[model samples]
Target: MAPATVRRDPGTVKPRIRPSPAPPARVRCATKRAAVRIAYVFDHRLPSTGADTEQLVHMVAALGEAGADVELVLPRIPGRQVPSPDDLAAYYGVPPSFRVRALPGPFPTVRALEKPGFAAVGALARAVRTADLVYTRNLPTAVAVRLAGGPPVLFETYRPWPDQYPASRWLFRGLLRARGSFRMVLHSHYAMERFLRAGLPADRMLVAHNGWDPRKFEPRLSKHEARTRLGLPMDRPLVVYTGRITPKKGLLGVLDMARRLPHVTFLLVGSEGEGSVEREARSMPNVRVEGWTDLASLPPYLYAADVLLIPPTAAPLSKVGNTVLPIKTFPYMASGRAIFGPRSPDLAEILRHGDNAFLVEPDDWDAATAGLRSLLEDPETAERLGRRARADAEGGTWQARAQRVLDFAAPMIRTA
Candidate 1:
């Protein structure tokens, strides 16, 4: 240092070199990456029975998987039986990301009956205010959310008649005329057409078919293995039907078929306790009825079956049977089992005769019986139809369905 100082002038002294500062550490804008928060409002309480609960759970899970934050909002009443979060997650197979928010309201029973009352409305409004979108299949809750005026509302209709209240119809028509901010999602082509005829704007309508999770419903065990595990007869040709044991489900026709074909075992997997349908089924030597089977236990039963029965009531034109497509159809198709059912427009949309399913005339026991017999006797045809049905189901998972709905609502969601 002393030698350098002597040799160089102070003004011309050299300085040590240093590396340029690293580019500002890359930062991701969290707002841009945040998931769209959705408030899923429902009029009914959870831990309930029926296909609606299953559909709602799976749809919520799918929406979460599709990058949307879903929170289930329902009325909360003191001293009511509500499922614990852990129980709900286990039942629905939902991830930790999915959540449930119960809005404080009057008693659960009263709130359920009068869902859009003042207290319920206040609760729903508060819940929806924090969300990017409000989704509901319950008409009253949908209307309430729409009126609350926070997030964009999406109303999904599975049945046409149930939501066609005179007041609701008038409100919907007015909303369409005013180009209201809400949208309607119909479950089937028939439902879309019905809503269109009912004065909903075509521009705001989306048709989303019911779907299943093949990973849940698909056959994981051999037929013999499943039958053995379930203690079902391994030798008999088993025809299975899984749903409420109601007459409107064409259980009468199934009973008739069971009587006609004594060799075939008719396994009816759901009954409302020991109700009339169970009594009728029990009277038949070939028919066996079991109480409700949980979702996890259903796959083995479906896999054990040779054919899946989907018999709608005699009145294919009835509101209960005709206007709505069965939610069970997708699961049946996903089970890789031949489906035999009446040829309604709802079924026709997804099923092809002699291809994925055997479509027969509605309420025609003779035709249904023949179809079941054909599936039982012809292994090649049954296998062919089942494989084709499974292939078709591959395209209709709950994930695909949720994505479709999200895509349809993308513009609205972004603006919201």
Candidate 2:
């Protein structure tokens, strides 16, 4: 029997998710219960440079670890180069166990023709048809797979869309309640709530947080060694923040902290390398902003830090369709550095104040400044917090995340 759906509010019914038996405790499992064939579809430029690409590849690799035969299907945009298996493997740092299929698409310059072309290819691909299900983060692929009567769709997302367009929203709403939607995976309960409010069924939703790959951080380097390797100062105390250097992520607030704490170095890794703010960052005497660092090279930067910051401001985020949970959180936890971040329901799912990290209210520069000062003043407490963060991080590995996803999709795979 399917899970029961209840009407919480008339004319604005919100959805709820039924939790699985997968424990909240340490998730170090690779049961390999049964082999499930999955064709993961995400149409984007090959050799992606964004964090989203990392998430997709890791999901496929983890699924493979859970005894699933997985193939990553993407569009072969005309005139654009497609990355070889080895290229992707080296860049993403994952075992090249699955095949990459580049289906035909329209000319790369033609934006409108691309989605239709990608969808048409998905509708006819043998990899998609033979698999137990078509799992996709791409909206076009999800829409295509269902309309063309392909396998079940596990449409996973962090938020709902088509809010402005009535017709598109209507179609997506139907797709959510459609017979072919096997599961709708969300990254957090905050995201789950967004979809629920968008009218998804209780049983149809699953919340699994994004995870980190432990291999990247293992054989951990010491702060002395890391700083030396990166040519950073040996004498200064560091407060580091990794990921996009945009105002939406509360960089402005972070910059203010640099002004207040002239003695402590505030480092911003992964800056876009140009723009007005970055120019201003270079002007600051206390702030040291570095250009975008690759994933493989990021651990050293993180390990060199005394504290990690994720200061997301009023960016139309937090328990919404936007990026509430930063991708760097897992790695920051794995690094065992004391984390200082905004206190929101979405972020609170992983980061806890006075527990794993030191939390402050979102968009509050004064609270953030005071929080960092407190952590710096008391070294013992900061070390204690870092230890707890590392201990808890053990359960949120890439493989562990894969096991949880497999556990949730077990029923559908078994029948397939």
Candidate 3:
């Protein structure tokens, strides 16, 4: 019967609901770690053979191990099926952390087809756009990414482009002058200087030597045991070279040495598809060409050798002549075997003559023969040099090299 009337001060304008200042825009502390997504563009097919393939495998694995989300952007043959990541990992002897993506294009083996198809370029550009950082060894691929206006790129140079591919000199110069966030990684100081002369900024250049997986290269068995496993004669001194059997690699000199020193057994552990170098070497009685040893099995051959030879020719005009720091050098050092090679500026940086290795004058076959003779005759000297080399290699593993690269790229990644 009675309606209760509540009387309030009309002046109490009920705290005008101000939306609690939107909770300070949620000072959201990011719970998950920011993963650095790296797009490594390479101009090669997966599960390929050669030093470049080996380097890519190690670099990708190392980057992954360094906590980066790494993916390899590679070329795919027009009609062929792409290999799975596991297949690639198995082929390269690397961990499954290294992932691969294929962009449809002409196979790298066909040098006539220099540039990738338009579709491939678009795909690569998209990948580069999404990545936090881009790393590439192929200048053409980097050029495509630059043209696409993608993220900052790091170009890793292993050779003097001007010398090897005179045709690409103009492209390389353009790359140096292009307006963008770009950096250069040279495999040797010589490479750095070459690029600097070609107009790259000094501050943007980094010299990172090629690296090896120490675990794979470490001497795992005794010399006799390794020789026995590899089916080598117990009496002869074994001299070995492991690399592509190209004329530019000074394989002819190795053959000559084999002919001169008939007593020593020369083992060439590498593929020999280029021209007649393999066939010629096979003709020699003292030279044994064991083609394409798997990465896992290479250590035993290195362990079996009394001395390792890196005999690239001194021809300044050859592809590998003036500006190559051989990838095998690091593994050779880690094998704890005496290394003998020409006095390449690149090699000299890591190897001191008579200290960690024996370096003779380039193309001086006489000096090379003499040095090999000395190493063969003096076990004490060889052992000392080998020990020094192994000590040097202890710090230069692929994982360590990857960490160095990541540290170098951190600033660029953050800014990107």
Candidate 4:
């Protein structure tokens, strides 16, 4: 059945739709039947697998593992460079049960609405209508999912875009309410709290933590072997900051840390987006900038590193980038390396001082360097911390993560 026409609230930035109250946990399973149809709407465009895509891939893979028939709705971007045939195969070959469909788009944005992105709304709505449930991983797609008629829509909002645009907050909130009687999923407790403050019903929101793909990041070769492969010096301690070279990622702080510890080799393994901090780290002999790596090659980099540096930039929007810990943390932990992080509210959940990770003030080179030096100088303490980190990561694999999503969505999945 198509959703009833939702009434617009004059005050809200977005249109409004009210979802039905979710049934109790016990009733969800008994009443619901058939294999759950889980639709993942997201972007799989190249340049790199952004955090949203990475999270989607793992979630889709896990949903399939949980016996849910999953279909991945990818944006069919034109003019964008597609991956090589081998890479394309690897990227799309998530899990057997998961399928991919591209929504053609080059949507021009007018005000807040993406016109081309809206092209996806019709097709996705049709697809969601057939499925047991509609699941959207990114914000742009969430708009389409909300507009579409479906069994039930459950959106995983990464951040509060409506909050960013106060002008459209009401409109977005209305649209959120109009999500065809669906649930909204969040990645962190921080995210959940944000939605609650925005007037989203607490029961309608859920926190699905990040999960890692164990295959891509397992305990590969030892530090010596891995370093040898990367051509990094085996003698000096190596601290790595992996991910895209963006401002919020705190690549500048990485340079500061490298300067503080000349004896420590700072290895950055990832591509640099426009306006990168590469220039600063380029000339330093102790630093190596390895641009763009395939997923297969990442294990060696993680294994070779003595510590993982997660220095997110100090900014209000930094929460968008740093709050939910990256999937890389899974492999970093599995590799049994000491991990360091910038003190941020979002990261507070994943990291604990002197436990799983060493948290320090963002851009505080003195404290960051001190933490790095402690890990480098005290091998016993480093090993103990690494052991704990690895244990924590191994427990948070895609399998476990998928299960969490299934359990959370059980209420809607059964009904859908």
RMSD in Å for all candidates: 19.2, 11.7, 20.3, 11.9
- Model 4, 175-232: lDDT tens digits are 5564345677777777667666767667767777776666655445888988887777
How far does residue 408 in candidate 2 sit from its true spot (Å)?
1.7
Task: Tell me the TM-score of each prediction against the true structure.
Answer: 0.86, 0.86, 0.85, 0.81
Choose 2 or 4, whichever is better by lDDT.
Answer: 2
Q: Candidate 1 residues 178-257, lDDT tens each? A: 35468888888877777767666788989899888655553477789889998888888999888877776767777888
**Highest lDDT scorer:** 2
Please list the residue runs of candidate 3 whose C-alpha ends up more than 4 Å from where it truly belongs after superposition.
Answer: 1-33, 106-111, 114-125, 162-180, 273-275, 316-323, 414-416
Mind giving the per-residue lDDT tens digits that candidate 2 earns over 1-416?
11111111211212121211222222222453435778988777756557788888878867776556778888886677777655666667665656788887654457777776787788678888777778888777888887887887887776545342335546666876664456778877877665656665767678888888777786698889889987777887888988776676677777778889888888887665465557667667778777665576778888898888887464636333357577788999999988888787778898889999998877777777888898988878888989999999888888788878877776555233
1 or 2: which has the higher lDDT? 2
What is the C-alpha local distance difference test score of each model?
0.72, 0.73, 0.72, 0.63
- lDDT tens per residue, model 3, 1-416: 11111222222212111111111111111234456788888776666666788888889877876677778877767776787756665565666565678776644456556355532473355766888788988766677777777777888878877655566657766665753457778888877777666665777778889887755653477799998887887898889888776677788887888778888888877763435666676566677776675676688888998998888356532443543778888889999999988887778789999899988888888878877887899988888999999899888988788878877766666332
